[model samples]
Target: MMSEWLVYPALGVIAGIFAGLLGVGGGVVIVPILLFVFTTQGFPAHHMMQMALATSLGSIVFTSIASFMTHHRHGAVRWDIVMGISPGILIGSFSGTWLAAQLSTRALKIFFACFLYYVASTMLRNFKPKPSRQLPGPLGMNGVGVVIGVISSLVGIGGGSLSVPFMMLCNVPVHHAIGTSAAIGFPIAVAGTLGYVVNGLSIADLPTPHLGYLYIPALFGIALFSFFSAPFGAKLSHKTPVVTLKRIFAVFLMIIATRILWGAL
Candidate 1:
């Protein structure tokens, strides 16, 4: 029990660093680790994935705030873009979580694993969008937000892996895209968390230390360290070759995705 206490916070530190460094919400890190921890801790098999997803979103609420503030200090975040897409994100995030509650646990695991692999491949290629069109109007941005929010909520991610690429496609600069994505995570986390909580309330068998589907202990442990470490990652991003780091992180994502797929099968 003591080891788990230490380990969860340590995971938060790692998740925070990665969130800041990559503009990812750390859900990519949090979900898999929680899957392992909950399974080992003898949590009910049926509800473990739901709990993990809920907790991942909960931590992202804090992690995104920390990361976004840090990026805002550097003037990287695009508040205009955030405003344009936020409404769609809020709607889509809640919708996606509701949909996830309808799916089987195995199906959700497979879906998330597949999504991770796609994100990993995109990062590995470092694909840059050609300046094919000017930045979209509000409607188009909202559409993009809907997709990002839906997919992110389903997979327990912050939507950066999808949003950064979409923003680049709209001719936004990479750094600004990353920063804006960090800001976007907040709406996704908030809406998704609420949806999960509501969904869990209808289920009678959730374990203790939970607020709805969210595991309170894990949320506290992860969010606390994540909040502190996010700034460190934000600082390092400027000094580091972020492209290289992103690719390395992508490789790590692929490895984790493979492990998840194996387990799901």
Candidate 2:
């Protein structure tokens, strides 16, 4: 038990550092780690995926804040984009949370496995830098935002994978796209966390130390350490080689996805 408690905080530090450095939603790491930890701790098999997703979303709340603040200070955030996406994200997140709650553990595991594979494949592709172009109009942006929110919330991710690609497709600079995606993660985290909390109210036999689906101990530990480490990640992002990092991340995601899929089957 003591060792498990120690591990949770250690997981937080590692997740935070990666989130900061890579701009990943942290789900890429947190969800798999939580699945391993919760399963090892004798959490009910059916509840493991739910707990993992909830814990991951909960951790992102703090990590996103730190990341957003860092990117904001660097003038990478596009306020207009955030505003355009906020409403759709709020609505979509709630819907996605409800959907996740209705899913059986087996289904959720398969879903996550597929999602991870998709993300990994995309990340493995080489991306060329592009110039920013004006989006068609409010309607188009809002349409994309809704999709991003729904998918991101359901997957327990920060929408960076989707949002960055969308921005890049729209001709936004890669740096600006990344920064804006980080900022957007804040609203997605807030909305998604609230949705999970509300949805978890109806679930019975949740593990101890839980509020809704969230494990308070895990949440507290992740938030505490990630808050400090995310800024460091932001600094590293500027200096790190992005293509190499993406390749490394892609390999990591592939391994995790295979493991999760195999475990589920």
Name the lDDT value of residue 149 in candidate 2: 78
For model 1, how does the per-residue alpha-carbon lDDT over 1-265 read when each residue is reduced to its tens digit?
6877898999999988987776566888899999999988898888788888989999889878877887799899999999999998998999998888888788889999999888888788987776567668889878878888899889998888888878887788888988898899999999999999998887888888688888888999998999999879878988999999989989999999998889889
Best by lDDT: 1
Model 2: lDDT of residue 260: 87
lDDT of each: 0.87, 0.80
Highest-TM-score candidate: 1
Q: Which pairs, if any, clash in model 1? A: none
Candidate 2 CA-lDDT value? 0.80
Q: What is the lDDT of residue 79 in candidate 1?
A: 98
In candidate 1, which residue ranges exceed 4 Å CA deviation?
238-244
